[model samples]
Target: MTHSVKPRARAADKRRRLTIEAARVLHEQGVERTTLADIARAADVPVGNVYYYFKTKDELVLAALSEHSAHLDELTGRLDQLPDPRDRLEGLIRAWVDQRDVAARYGCPTGTLAVELDKRADGTLDTEAGTVIRRLLDWTGHQFRALGLPDPEDLAVTLISAYQGMSLLANALRDPDLMARQGDRLLHWLDSLQSPDPTA
Candidate 1:
């Protein structure tokens, strides 16, 4: 196979590389304690260069959230291969929990940013997370419809809400054991959804 790179592609590559390095910094430190100068130092790039790619700290945080959401998108993409709504829903629950687990292992930046969002209502970083989460739930609902569930949208909402609730609960408990238990029970609910009729 032969390949060619366009100028736009090259520019995107540079930005991606910078964003990736920044993500590592954010994961290690945190959004509140992190500064563009710190990321520039870590990335071995000039502060001006970091500013060239991202105009503000909020934009950089949004990029980190984008990176996290991209991980979710990749897992959800696998549902196309499952071919069973029941299996897909179960897989979705497991995948989402694992996403949280992995993010938790890395200090759970998504959850951290969410708390920041609440503290500063008009911070605007919420826009990216809100959109990404909605997209994830929308995709999950589509799978629910395929499984013959009634009101797939409502079911998706419930599942998403449950997952978010468990995430917050796990953060509070800080116990991996409880997280795994809640994850199993969450998937069990999805399994129950495979019935001919689902109430609520």
Candidate 2:
């Protein structure tokens, strides 16, 4: 079987690469602290060239947010493919816990970025930033509902709160192990969930 090398789609590839890099820098340094120049340096694109893709800092941040949003959506869809609803929830937990080192060092990517952007003086990007968490909440709620749980929305809020709270403490205390330990506890909690009474 003969094969030929695929050619690069340079513009689209560069935009995608630059967007991912921007998301990384935004998560690590934060939206306010991160500049297009910083993202360009991280993306290895010329600073002047960045303007060709994103005209302003807000535009780049939006691109990063869009990238993050798509990632969360993809993750949720993948989780939904699990044969068991419980497994799906646990998979989501494992996904976040797998990032223990990064979470401990930089905090939860979505949580931190959402909070940072929400607290911005301008408040222009607040709603866009919040969509990340909202998407997670909605997806988690759907999973809980799939498990035949009443109060699925509430349960989803509790689970997300627990994950975000652990990330916050782990980051604040600089304790990377804390996330893993909390993840273990979360797994146990998952095991303990009983399907709520539908009639209640």
Candidate 3:
């Protein structure tokens, strides 16, 4: 006899699928254009089921942002495997550079969504949507601090801004090579910041 699946397990599975589908749809279509029905269709769940997991579109947006946050955390953790903070930062830049094609086609997921959410005053996302960039800033700032920069936070902001700017231009121009070139410039800048350690 086949055993029946538990309610909680099924619910968790549905929630996970919803989150994944929401992220995909939100990335492909801006928040204003993506409806719950689109997400439900993508996730293969009943449209009514979306309400059980997310009461409103805003809730699903926040859930998608949370998913992006988790992805950033995982990337940070992977970068941490590098011994040097500078190397970690390079790894971060390289990671973005590697996604140049995707960025060109769809824009940076976090950057695009953050800007979209900020333009709204309907309480759809507010400052909470910006947490994705803030997390990157904080993490990059920490790496800069480890590199002994006096103004690590500012440096972090600059780096993040540069990456965002590159993404914006690349997406607007639909030029993946532009992003890769910018990535090289960022790596060169990072290299310039390096000097012979006084202690060594």
Candidate 4:
């Protein structure tokens, strides 16, 4: 029984490593250009082992997408622990700011993958890729709603759009400062949202 469990654990670890490496390769090279061999090399697993874990490239891509979604959930779950909704929102922006260099180099992992998959004619991969953004949107919207905002969903969209736009510009321009500056502006915007309306 112990030996069987050990092998199962090792297999699970290898599978997870493959998915993680796949996500990294996909983020760096885009989905169309990434091959199973690339992922296997990056994960330091045998190419045949990759086949054992994922029968095809699409299955591996799907696993990578799930990995991204799980990461996003963990991040948002951490942010959700903050006592203040505004603080939570600001924390989200700060996370982007912290990752600005990576975003500038490779673009937002989730964003880039989603955009690339969205171009495919089949539409299946696009749906899977979208779950990451949907989770982000839902979490952000929940923060806005908690703050008693009238247009929580709209506010969430606005914030996420700003981040995505900044990411695109930073990556296109290869300017990490652009993301940092955007983060400052977004932090100010969050503060503005919390300000008491003069009309009130």
The most accurate candidate by TM-score is 4
Tens-digit lDDT track of model 1 for 54-122: 999888887878887876678777776887877877887676566665444543455556666656657
Whole-model lDDT, model 2: 0.88
The TM-score obtained by model 2 is 0.91
Output the better candidate (1/4) by TM-score.
Answer: 4
TM-score of each: 0.78, 0.91, 0.93, 0.96
Q: After superposition, how far is residue 24 of candidate 1 from its true place, in Å?
A: 4.6
Question: What stretches of model 2 exceed 4 Å from their correct place?
Answer: 1-8, 197-200
**Between the candidate structures 2 and 3, which one is better when assessed by TM-score?**
3
**Model 3 regions more than 4 Å off:** 1-5, 195-200
Question: lDDT scores for all predictions?
Answer: 0.73, 0.88, 0.91, 0.91
- Ranked by lDDT from best down, the candidates are 3, 4, 2, 1
lDDT of 4 by residue, 1-200 (tens): 99899999999999989989988899999989998999999999999898898999999889889889888888888988899999999899999999999999999898999899889888788887777798899889999998888789999999999999999999999999999999999999888886345589
Listing every candidate in turn, what is its Cα RMSD in Å to the true structure after a full C-alpha superposition? 4.2, 3.7, 2.2, 1.7
lDDT of 3 by residue, 1-200 (tens): 23456777888999999998898899889999999999999999999999999999989998999998998999999999999999999999999999999899889998899888878887548577687889899999999999987789999999999999999999999999999999999999998885447897
In candidate 1 the C-alpha lDDT for residue 40 amounts to 80
Lowest summed lDDT over 10 consecutive residues: which window, candidate 3? 1-10
